[model samples]
Target: MAEAVAAGRAASRGVPGRSASGRSRHARILAALVALSALVYAASSLLRLRAFQASTYDLVIFDQALRSYSRFGAPVAMVKGVHNGFGPDFSVLGDHFSPILAVLAPLYWLHDGPETLLVAQAVLFALAAVPVWRYAARRFGPVSAHLVAGAYALSWPIAEALAFDFHEVAFVPLLSALLVERYDAGRRVQAALAAAGLLMVKEDMGLLLVGFGFFLLARRGERRAGAAYAAAGIAATWASSRVLISLFGGDNDYYWAYGSLGDGMADAAVRVLTHPWILPGAVGSPPVKLLTMALLVVPLLLLPLRSPLALAALPLLAERMLADRFPNWWEPGYHYNAFIVAILVMAAVDGAYRLRGRRPPAALTRLRPVAALRRSRPVAALRRMRPWRALRRHLPAAALLAGAVVTVPFFAFGDLADPGLYRPDGRDRAAGAAVAAVPDGALVETANNLGPALSARTRVLLWDREPRGAPWVVADIGRHTFPFTTLEEQRHRVARLINEGYRPVFRQAGYIVLTRESAAPR
Candidate 1:
């Protein structure tokens, strides 16, 4: 087994056709591309914040959580608590099992603001390119490596994650790539470490780890390790979601998105086993689910379908698709897809390599007729065709790269081309002034759009329905903000506050700053 594995590795190295210096040069070029990607991602996200396009539901929630972490306090996110009607003492962990956000606390130590989280997320997304390039280089050539790396970096999943806000998934792409690359390279220890980190990212990440274990089990001499990993993943997911989350004051019932399947996980599993069509029924009824599944593979020209490594994505995909409560999970948007981007791209590289080497799947090798047909005249003639040869080798990567480039104009990255992305208008200035009117350290209720802007300075609660009686209020009445469906609803709320002794102290560009008359002035 060792000899055969070594021979395969040698063949992969030889196929790349690069000398030591050439390989080093390619590495340097790939590094430059990764740096450029990071810059672009950071600039785009930060610019959105500057333009008042960032929302408080998430960006501010994460910001508040990270702030507590930076200060060595509990992972409290008042924005989330206030929005959800939980009190200011609420811990973010009670909502989702992502302790990995604490790793980013050091970034807050340097900048101490929401912008720090956005920049950190961009860097994390860009860092995945390194592992992706290394893995692709081992399978394909240097050129294909670069193409795959670029494609992964610019993929729509990462773009959507960036467009939405900072999320725990920012750590997923890099860790998933590392796990696949290191495991394939026979460095089980590093791969295990990556898997461990993945478990920290979210409670559901263990399902992805379990899928990877199934992938490993299919490979020679890996069954023992695979079994151990699969068992660990199962244990970790159960402990984290059921025990850890509950221990942290979270209600797991809130995440029961599979009500349509059954009462709970056990019931759903039993139903899925007994009525297999139930899974398909759920996925098919919403035609958008099919479109999303297609969009995931279509960009890579369906190469992922050919590799068993794609199994790593199945659990997560099923988790999202089977959930009927959250429509966003079934759609091809937000940070939901970011978890599988690395797995899909790595599988595509593996698929292309298998095609280039003319390696038939193990199952196909057992079929006598299939083996005989390989030596047939028609097969030989087809192999000799230039287009057929190209399709089996370099063309796959080139076509994938071309497709990625072609599709960039339709995704969030395309916003970089619009001049408006760079310009912050009067609304932004007014929001800033409104944020400024609320003195530092004062308790302020802010609109969902302006929460992040003041979260760094003021103690902010979401200015949603039912005033929290905060001493200072900053809301945008000129346009509708989150939690308020109409502009009149926002205006009426502000008017009610005024009649109750809260007076508008600052108003500009439809932004209003109100302070309670009875409260001591700052």
Candidate 2:
């Protein structure tokens, strides 16, 4: 492996003006991937929106929160409990304290719908390719950099996340990629801001930041900065659960997820720590953990394992592995992976590059694209470091393991082949019309899947919840709404609206809209 790297190194060095040519090639690859990734994700998400694939659970949370911000109201989820759990009229901040959503809130004033959230999510996720491409370019040559960028952008986990719905997690990849880029570039202020942006995406990200800070301190020699990062992350995590979310969301504070361990966050922590011997058991036995590792790392070729930067992902991995939440915590192609995917990819690039004990040469910094990296201490130091023969010895194993992934079936691909997932039809149009008939800020009850369409309103009750105070209700009587019971049950429930003085405002296409008799007309 060293001989191969040495030969490749010599070829690039022997040619006149080769370095400049290589930097130009890297620039083109980065530019192409960034553009292609953004376009595909944005177009696909928009198509999903036009179809009926987008759901209420997450899309509504993001849209309603943004609506509140745009309208200068408190961040209330109009569609809370429709597809997931939360109190009606609940502030989204109370749930996750993601103040960062406020940054894009103004867009709702110009356009109001779930599509806005979808577009924003797509853009954010695709923008992650920018940093990933740059990092890969620095790690590998301009030629191999293309392959890394392709994998980073087209990873099943990332595609699955984009196809699912709008999540604060969509922001995770962008922020994480930026974190690694700025940190490696030695742009302290930019890196710190990137880290801060990550915590604003979700409370759990604070713990991951603590791990990141530890890696920087232990591996990169940035003592003071690392200490500050660790302290900030620890404080933010404590505040997110204990102070911010607790004061806003109540004592539950999302600790219900760890019900098997204890009652709440405090109890769970105490239980885990006090029983030191239970650490092994916490990960659900050795074999299961090994399987989980393969699921995560195999797709990426296990490149993350070759670097100390892998430690940045440890806290998040531990968090997911120890959870008993619907087998979702262990899944590879889901929203949970959004938190660690970008970090792992960046780590993988570093790992692969470190195999030869080389870093981006200072000459590469002369290029406009990498001019941000003005410092070259990493390269200077690595030039003096000894060869990593251990990594060389394992190259064959890594190559063989990476080769197996090529044989996996397209069925193992991230997205489904269902036509309904990508096309709009009568039911979708009917649902939208029903939601549109209701006035803005009107109190309405709706099906689980349809809730996000009306999420811009200030009042909405989920299908499972009793429609006690709702002044208006919309139901797709002929169809089944997800995360709820049968269509027959929904039709029966809608039939009962007559006893509550609700008169039909509009009825067509298996959709029925109703309002209380004593209320205003449609």
Candidate 3:
């Protein structure tokens, strides 16, 4: 009988069987760590809000869309519409199929501020660590699971993307993590819900699901499920291309990321199907592809590669590497990582489970370089030293701790690779107060940072735009360094505003609030 095991078993961390309480204790610890992650992310949110670090471009666009949804209307993005030449009320929903933002509409009714969105983003990113904890704990043991969760909570990509600004991609990590966990556990219903949730996030998720379906086919051998997922992805891609975005978004297709392949998405698709070798050549060169993988895997100690799950990242990797327009996508730091990071970490945790409590192979110790070192009397004596046994026993824990340390910088700024963005002096109180005075529904042209605050209150055009009889204009003349480099260039627009029948209403700290001479305060 090959060793009859106990009906209920016990092992420490990754040692396998454990009593119920031990598992609960591990979960509680991991939860506490996730809370810590939330606190850290919240602090970043606060800094961004108070310091004027947040931008109106993305924030205002999202808030407008969410508010429109709250009002039970099509998500016509007033802000994005103006700048992209899409008119004052174009459907942002067409641009990206994120009905998921509607879920946040109720929350907007409660607090109705851009800060609400920021904190929500922080919480979502923090919660993503849950699946990481669950997967890692089950595979590696609770202790190592906590380590993986902590490292995941601090993963560079999450921090950078969150810190950069609120994006629809905020939901990606959580959804992807759920998809992996439920799928691995054979919870088909939950897995399908999670997979469907991805399409609701953004159009790109359709392709991602197709790739993941293949991963499922290859790994799970569930041909029906895999084919269904792929079919759904293909359907979404076709719908988005032919109808969805075209109906709601700008007049032209905006998928310029693949501009290198052809004129637009249609041409790009043709090129991809007809010319198979185009993928390898357009991976931004082999060296870049190698570096992109290294940056992603190195922070986790290259453990994710042990699992076939890494194959799921291929569609995203291909999408990015193939995009000649978005060089930023070729790197690990930005919002691009939001889509790819979860599964890689899941793979790492799963890999760690296989690694836990195992000794280094005799083959590893017997490698030529190791054997040569062992032949040295000093090295051999060191290997025979007192602490060697202890080192062997705790080596896995040490590795987890070390990798966690390596990824610490990312935790500092809500995204690891972009630390220089942390300018703590971000709040402009006087400017905020002036912005608060603007009435809701009034047309106002405002600075980038100020736009998020005033989004719900008024129609905000980018500051530099010619007011075109807009009733108000707000400019922080001295606050010229962020959101864009064109703020100083807008100084000329101030003269233009005065020339075009606008009068200054308030001025302090380079923040000048203006209204049309016809509509100026009596």
Candidate 4:
């Protein structure tokens, strides 16, 4: 591994006119950009949590699960299970196969809080830049490599994921980039290891591996590995969804969000084949799905469309777009798109190389038209122009970096510039006091936004329409919060808690903390 890395560095330095010292300087600059991105990512998420803008639905659920893992317990997320009526014994694995989250358990030993997960996610997102830089630097020289890495670091997909909250998908970008870079570098062992890691991130990640298998099968001397990967991916997805999730007390059909197409995967596949015309309507019904598909490739100037490596992103995209049940699945937001960011960016890099008259590498050798186009009269005439000749090498990188800069103000990272983000006002202060009013080790039901604030110290449950009879309840009734539609509804629910042997011990800023008269800590 060390030898391979050294050789890759040497190859980067071999780019015309780049001395080892100059290459080192460029590496330093890219490293600094990555570090800055990490800082921004972590700060945005942490600030969102501190400002009381984060929700319990996922942040708290993941925090509770991570807390359980840190304590060497089953990854039971009471916040998620109780809210879903799945009971306290429910393991998150039953909901989504992300056992790889257990690897971060040790970090909880240092600081067992939701912030730990956010920071770790930021680091992982930024670390993906290393592989991205290596891959681009190998082909486009150090300057373009740095720009590509910067574009990836600040991409909208990653910014959206960071804005939403921590998720297992945080592992997707790093592992996906590694899989692409290592495979392209012909380090099959390392690439396979990365692919294996992705399988542990999510059950559906097998689709990515399957797509990569298709890419490998098309390459000479790679059919054996491709066949093995494809088989393993199929088996893993089947076992995890059909057996493991059920073993952990979850229903597989719970997330089968394609009922409009058919009953399940097989039925949907059969339906799509039998009625091919239905495909267009199924994928484009909402129109937003098409926008999302376009956004995924547009930032890279649609260059990924020219590379077969982009095939790896298709299955996951298809999985989301074809599902009519969940809007979030097809929406242009959240961690869903994070899964494909690295794949598309790397594919764009390959496409850029092919556009530069470089023969397609390995399996991509079949794309001879790309080279032919480079030699055509129009392209040749453009190349003969002094300006085009001078600027052509940097065009892709410059366009990518410019795209990121143009879009930054519209994404989560833009929140960094908002003074309100850094200023936690009265609501935040009241939330802090209300969370603190609840005693440690107590069973408490809390509002969706308050769940993470209290999760670290309390056995937190969702304070929803139905009362769970928790010993303590904390709610922010000043405004409508998640799982509740209106302030009137939230107030009514709190009033019912008061009717059921509970008294408000702390009330300020629309925040209320209640303790049951006869209830014990447990």
Where does model 2 exceed 4 Å of error?
1-25, 81-89, 220-225, 249-252, 285-293, 356-426, 429-442, 456-460, 477-492, 503-511, 517-522
lDDT of 1 by residue, 94-162 (tens): 899999999899888789889999988898898888778778877667777778888988898899899
Q: Output the number of the TM-score-best candidate.
A: 4
lDDT of 4 by residue, 247-297 (tens): 889998888988878998799889888998888888997999999998888
Residue 251 of model 1: what lDDT? 82
Candidate 3: tens digits of C-alpha lDDT, residues 105-216:
8888887767777878887887777776667656655666666777777677776787667889889888998888778766889988998898888877888788777777
- lDDT tens string, model 2, 119-192? 77766776676666556655554455455656666665667777677888878888988888777766778888
Which scores better on TM-score, 1 or 2?
Answer: 1
Instruction: Give the Å shift of residue 209 in candidate 2.
Output: 1.0
Off by over 4 Å in 4: 1-18, 218-221, 357-391, 520-522
Ranking by TM-score: 4, 1, 3, 2
| Candidate 1 global CA lDDT score | 0.83
User: Considering every candidate listed, which one attains the maximal lDDT?
Assistant: 4
Model 4 clash pairs are: none
Model 3 misplaced stretches (Cα beyond 4 Å): 1-16, 249-252, 273-277, 285-292, 331-333, 352-369, 372-401, 410-430, 433-441, 479-488, 517-522
Q: Considering TM-score, which of the candidate structures 2 and 3 is the better prediction for this target? A: 3
Task: Give the TM-score comparing model 1 with the true structure, all chains together.
Answer: 0.88
The Cα local distance difference test for each model comes to 0.83, 0.68, 0.72, 0.85
Would you give me the overall lDDT of model 4? 0.85
Quality of model 3 by C-alpha lDDT: 0.72
